[model samples]
Target: PPATARPAPAPAARLAGIWQQLAAQNTEIADLTAIKNHFERVLAGRTWGDPVLLHGDLTLRNVLVQADGGVAVLDTDLALTGPAAYDLGFLDASLDFIDRWQVLSRGRLYDDAGLGLARMALRDGYDAGGAADDVALCRALRLLQRAAELGEHVQRTRPALARVLIPRLIHPYFLAAAARALGVG
Candidate 1:
């Protein structure tokens, strides 16, 4: 049987479960909450064009380079219909997360100029029209979402002390990055 595409959650609704998990963990990320509120306020009563098919979990890990120089996307289980910006934003945030993680874990920094060029190329390649702000907001949201997911993963898999410590150490960087994406201080 062919898989059916489900409608993705609305922007505000997308982060609801993450917020619940954060609350359960007693994580107080005020900046993340601010980003969410700002996203809701800005997108309220606004239309983001018609929803389109999305690679709901698009990221570097899900892509592969073929021998013929083409690319393949794996893990289509999360495929759905949503605003096109969602996928782009998710990819952007994923790259940012990787860059930050590398710096934190290995003390190595990727080329900021190259990353900037790549981001610019990505935006130019996509016909985003007037939705630049939408992309930015979605990027911020994805950062927060990724951070919460990391915390959850740590909680489930790591030792008790790590469960308490890793999230505390890692989440602030993600929150700050999200804040920067949203133009917050």
Candidate 2:
């Protein structure tokens, strides 16, 4: 074979892509105002086969490397009854974003960049142990969440991170998901 790849679309990739499709459709300014409510509603209604407690916003910064090589998590702000693996995906995405977005000139973390890194790290930790198969779906949903948040911050000016955070954390995350879901990548 010229190149070897599976003929079937990975379950995880398809899962990740759904959020990207949702994000692209919700590009309008209204999605932000309605997003948090949507997530809450969807989460409350849906249940997966492996449903378990989840940290809604698990990321690298939340996870602590223990002296004995164990991982610990903090920040239950995003916790819900959902996929634990998805939580790990968020962490992994955070790590990747941080590594890519760091600016030596400022010698400090930027808004989206730092947040991305935190997300990537969480996912990486999870995927590394085989969750990689389904990590894409979680990443996609993350971006959709970001787009919604951005819209809200745009009009209200509360989060104040609409441009910086959403672009860094949400856009690429969803795009990555889209690629996986559509098999463009």
Candidate 3:
């Protein structure tokens, strides 16, 4: 836990504004409100352990392996204090996004078995204790947050003609994956 890490809002609260922006841009994604509500309810019922310093953005790109078999983390700009599960879930969701993004953008297919093994290793290596459900919940929330951010980005950067394609294609994918992570449909 680093002193530089800031405190973050609750997951549902963090998603609310982004969700509003995304839903405003694409009406099709409005149907995701139900899923969002479900996330709010689930999170409302859970008890997140004491806040701890977190890297905030824990993606593969931010991690380094040292020659002496040590590990290092980079990019503390998004560091925040929250449940330990947040970092674990953020890393898991990031890996999942990278795998799917490759398939969507480059038509490259990766082995699911390898990804599964990596996820298992992540879970095994972390001492999450009894917060396994919290981890899954955070993962689902992060996926939805990523989707909302992408939608907002596309709306801002893409041309009117091209703006709809990326969000339409990937938003639902993220939503479905998020649902699965939440143990829903």
Backbone clash count for every predicted candidate, in the order shown? 0, 33, 0
Per-residue lDDT tens digits for candidate 2, residues 35-84, read 43444444454544444456666654455554344556788655565455
Highest TM-score: give the candidate number: 3
lDDT of 2: 0.48
Can you tell me which runs of candidate 3 are displaced by over 4 Å?
1-4, 29-31, 66-69, 99-132
Instruction: Output the TM-score of candidate 2.
Output: 0.48
Runs in model 1 with CA error above 4 Å?
1-3, 64-72, 99-133
- Candidate 1: tens digits of C-alpha lDDT, residues 40-156: 777688677666667788775665544333445689989987777887788787776644564245544444554455455545534553334477778888887877777777778
For model 3, residues 1-185, the per-residue Cα lDDT tens digits are 55666787887677686578667656465437667778777767667776776778887667654434345679878878877788788877877663457424554443455445545555654554333447777788788777777766777777574355645676877888888888775
lDDT of 2 at 9: 25
Residue 76 miss distance in model 1 (angstroms): 2.5
Candidate 1 residue pairs in backbone clash: none
Candidate 3, residue 47: Cα displacement in angstroms equals 1.9
Which parts of model 2 have CA positions greater than 4 angstroms off?
1-47, 98-132, 158-185
**Candidate whose lDDT is highest:** 1
Q: Local error of candidate 3 at 96, Å?
A: 2.0
